[model samples]
Target: MNALLVITALLAATPITLEETRTQGRKNTQALQAELDVTVAREDQRSARSNLLPQVQLSAGPNLSYQGRRRQVVTIPVTETEVLTREVVSSANTSDSYGASLGLSQVIYNRGLWKQLEQAGVNVDAVRNQSIEEADTSELEAIRRFFTLFLSQATLDVLQATAKRSEEQLERARALFHAGRVGKTEEISAEVNLGNDRINVVQRQSQLVADQVQLAVWLARPGTEALQAVDPGILQQEPAPAPALDDALKQAREHRALLRALQQRVRVAELQRAIVRGDYLPRVGLQAQYAHGNQDLGPFFSEPGFGNTFNGGVTLTWDLFNGFNTDAQSARAQANIRRAELTFAQTARELEAEVRRAHQALDGQIASAKLATTNRAAATQGLMLAEERFRAGAGSTLEVRDAQLKLTQAELVLLQSRIDVEIARYALYRATGTLNPGDSQ
Candidate 1:
């Protein structure tokens, strides 16, 4: 963290860079984006699991019908009386019908369902790793953006220092003219030089602001026009040590999301093959049903009646041959599994290469930053000696100014080198597959 500037504190301040200002913003956004990516990935796994569970549904319906010539057996009456004997027979015709039901289904034995569920569970895990990869990627981007802004701000500081020196020189030249020691033309040339320096300073400042905005946009923060701080330590904080190339490569193979996703893809293909082969087997299930309806008997006997019916059975399903779809599907799954294995192989090689390169970069930048520190210290010492010489009238103003310029350049370079080290360390971390999520916290 850099100290916030108060007016009195600004008078005693060591200026900081735009990079330090915007890094916080980008870091915040990276956390948010990471969470979103992982959440989406996990949801896909959950969706696949739903297919394996038994399904239940509620249903209601009414039915009506009209018909003719309904018939049934009838019992006839026989009787004899004085001067009279009688025989009875029965016959009739009529029609009407109606009904409704609610149904439920549970998977008893489906070879494909269990296998698909397994695939879904693994796929969800793969997505979680993919989110980690996304987080690593986001962190890398933030580091670059933050440091690039720092670069712009360092350049701006150099220009501002030059403009301040030019203005002071112009004032001194004008004073010398008033004392009749320097000519009017010399003073006029100083004025022109100072004006040009002012323009360069303003342009560089603008560039710094633009760079800061670029980084801050990622964090979703408002832009600061010019960076301000009371201390410069934020620009110099170095990251931790890097690992060996072989170690980095080995770690990446285990932690990289792309590799995990491809592995899961191959697993899914194998599951598909298992399911296809299952079609050759049988799916057996049990079922029971109850129904009631009105049955009429009319010709030999006339009446309306009702009866209940019950049924129970074991059902077996087998696709004797599905136009060779099973064979074709299994063939496709086998090809896909092979492709996934090939893809994983290719990606692992690429990841290993990246890890090795990042390791080298990390090592190189560490050395660069050390040299930059030594150079800046020497330059600062030189600037002090030059100022002392000028105070004693033994050195020219030009020499003193040159030393100051060199020192300023050295500081700027050192700041950049430090940022380079930071960026390299982060790249190595990402490449080595050690970038952790939840950084915003």
Candidate 2:
């Protein structure tokens, strides 16, 4: 009893809502890596922008030297008499020198680099949009897995209930056969039906276990934990009417992250082409530097003997020719721009088709769900009447068996229809680029 209580408590604690599952899935490595890509893109933008800013550099170092000296005698003439004079010269000297220099450089004109900066900005936008699209895709995957598990569990439950009813019917058949009210063949048929139901139950149970394992992996949960879906009715609420195809297409154009990212790519390609064109123009910049040097570190700044110099100049560089490298690059850039434009156009058409398909599918599922609900109600009434008639000895076992089968089939169809509607609704949301965890209801 104590062990059973512990198991029950564990199971109770393990059940998670759809929202919680979505939250856990977003913490997965795939989603986190997408977010990291966004950060990397932002840093790249900053790096590109830094190239256009004034660059200042400073350098300082110390040097030590050793010297040797030699002495020489020279002859000098004074008042018609020759005199001897001593002269000294140093071949080497020991000295400590310290020097510091500061330099600044600014781009005055470099259209290529400027365009590159613009392209980097566009790249950042593109990556950011891509990240959002990745997030939506991940969340949709999680939702799909959740629904699959839910449907499996529901099927298992239905099978278990059907098995229970089959057992009861088998008991009735046995009693009737013993009393000679029913033939042996009828009893045998009930026995076979009960066996089939048991087999189905076992199979469904296995499927439920497999689905639970899959969902556990997605949620990053331990395999030992039991996973139970919340009531299907929570998700079976009627969905709102789908928008018209034209409206859906318009919404997709406005909201689709993939399209936004591709548009940014077009901008990036355009800027790249501009940058290549700039290669034909001369590059110009301003360069300035200040330097001070002396034999001693401390006296370098205070002493007048130190060499101090400041220089400033404007520089222009023209690459007259470089083995036609610029020409080839320009051609490539132009081609890329054309490719990007074509790709964007193709993707837009594909997105429109996707939205239209999702809209129609959702509509069909909703209608099917309504029809299934009505059929299940009728089947339930038929089962009740057949059971009553069998008890009154006015109907045969086969009639009851057929009614039960119809009812089971109807119930399963109804369940499936509801699940399909929910799945289709989410699909439509995904097609419109509006799917998110919060919108799952």
Candidate 3:
């Protein structure tokens, strides 16, 4: 057992990929809540379906009764010729009765119940589709947090490298100052730059810690454990081309879970309207019951001592008037149907707009990433020249520092632009309702 426990602990601490984290988040977070809702909806559908089947009930009980004395006059013939009047009396102290009954009711023709069953089915579909949407949303969130942590870690790497370079520069400046080849100001500037870089390293380290904790919470893990994310190939590959706006809009309409859920809602509302209208028609049902009783508890089921009863019937019920309640309900259902239609239309338009925006943003990020790549190359070349000139004593200290700073900024920009391009692709996927755990790359 101890060995097993150790293995489990080690497994828990293992680094996970982005896809794994997404799956874990779904199991542990709001996605599970959506799954529970789907379960409840399914149960509701089951309950509605049950109304179409026969309902049976069984009952058993005992009863006790007491009766007071009663007197009655009676006529009797005596001595073969004369008639005589006589008094008779009867009384009972207590009587015990035991009874058992079973009854069954079945709906033969209930339009309302049929329509309600249909509505419940529609509701299940809507809830399931909504759950899918929730899962997609959770997956996108997990991706965002994963990449944020990755970016923070990459930034720390840059800061650490820059700090090492600054330290070397400071040492060179100090040597030059001691030999009287450079002024004190040059050494002081190098020292200040090194200190700033060190401070930035600290800040970035703190940010990385915070990001790690946030992701741990999302994955339902211990927040203090150091968690690392494996690259899921999103960063290495070039961003895919965005689809045309018209094609994206079409995909959004056809594949978006939210839109599909809304469409189901419209159908549910229509069914609801039909169900309410059904109240205007008569309902038919069948019922049967069997009952047995005995005054004494013993031999309750005996043929001579027990009483048996059986009853069966077909029933029809109609509501002639109910203070216009049905009319009000029908009107409300109609209004709901109209509201659902409007909402569906509104959601489609909003989704189309979102798709367009995400596509545009992706295009822009791709362009920016390409631009940053070119700038980083140029900055690297400029830094190399600046350092070479400084070593040859042909360039000033300020020129070298400026070139280094520019190169660092360009590197940071390129990293950011790459992350942005990947994020924008994810956004486009989400806008088109295609984001899923399997699409982590």
Candidate 4:
């Protein structure tokens, strides 16, 4: 009993709503990788920005030396008038020394470096936009899976209900045949219908299981079986009006992440051109250094050894020329900028067409849903009338069977139409770059 209860609880914990599905789907590998890319880009931007600040360095080390024994000559005064020469011997000795230096450098002017820093910032924005696009894609996929699972469940429910009705019809036909009110053919026909419905039910159940496994994989669930999709009753609601084409296009222009990323790339390329051109100008900086050390004037430390030095200066560097390398790079940067601009233009056109296509599709599906609703209502009434006539012995078994089949067809069509309408609406939203998990209803 406890084990069964635990299983039931786990089953209930499975996500069924669109929001929950989106929450799970956001952990998809592609989306996470995009986020990681954005983080890396941000780090690069920081590194580039840090180059504008002063750089400081410190160094310290010890030095060692040795001297070999050698002979030296000395002159001495004698009787204040004559000088005497003598030979002197110097002993071998060793000395140890240590020094430390601290230096600071700050760039006063480096146009190329500043331009490169700007490019880094733009690259970060591009990566961030890509991450948003990836997240939206994953969320849209989750929405698709949610609806697929819902449709499968709805289809199976319909099959099961039809199968139950076929069973009753079969039983009734057999009773009438035994009473001589109907023939064996009628009984056989009813049995055949029941068998077909059962087969359909089995097939639909298999499909439902497959869809469940698919959704489970997205959710990272270990078990694929025993999942259930509860209907959110979206089908019963009235269809919403289609969005205006002008509005959709405007939204696509304003909100599309991929387009924005492309625009950022164009800016990046323009910055790259400026950076390359900046190489033609001189770079200026200010630098300062302080050093302190102790060393023996003689190998035996015979003299004062402590000393310190401080220095400060301005520096300038000019490339002048480097085998036309800067010119070639500048040309390449310009070409890349052109390429980026063209890509953005092409994508903008494609996006507008996509929105228009989606708008038309949504409108069509809404019309289909409205038609299906009317057909289903008529089918329901026809089935009731056929059943009444058959119970009164004024109609044949075939008429009742036909009515039931028509009603089943109508119901299936209605279900499909409703699903299509919702899918179309979301497809439009995706095309306009407005799709999100919250819109899944």
* Highest TM-score model number: 3
TM-score of 3: 0.89
Q: Which whole-number lDDT from 0 to 100 does residue 385 have in model 1?
A: 92
Score each candidate by Cα lDDT.
Answer: 0.65, 0.80, 0.83, 0.82
TM-score per candidate: 0.73, 0.85, 0.89, 0.85
Instruction: Tell me the deviation in Å of residue 107 in model 2.
Output: 1.9
lDDT of 1: 0.65
lDDT tens digits, residue span 44-108, model 1: 66776666554544433334454544444543445543343344443453445433233434567
Which is superior by TM-score, 1 or 2? 2
The clash numbers for all candidates, in the given order, read 3, 2, 0, 0
362-388 in candidate 2: lDDT tens per residue? 899888888888998899999899888
What is residue 9's positional error in candidate 4, in angstroms?
Answer: 12
- Top lDDT: which candidate number? 3
User: Tens digits of per-residue lDDT for model 3 on 1-441?
Assistant: 322432353356547787787678666568889999999999999999999999999999999888888897989988788989999997657888999999999999999999999999999999988988888887777778888887876777677778878888888888878888778988898899988888887787678778888888877788887676665675566667777888878767767889989999999999998998898999999999999988877768565435989999999999989899999999999999999999999998888889999999999999998898889899999988987886666766688789889989998998888888887888888888777634321
Predictions: Cα RMSD each: 8.1, 4.8, 5.4, 5.4
Report the lDDT of model 1 for residue 372: 85
| Candidate 3 lDDT score relative to the true structure | 0.83
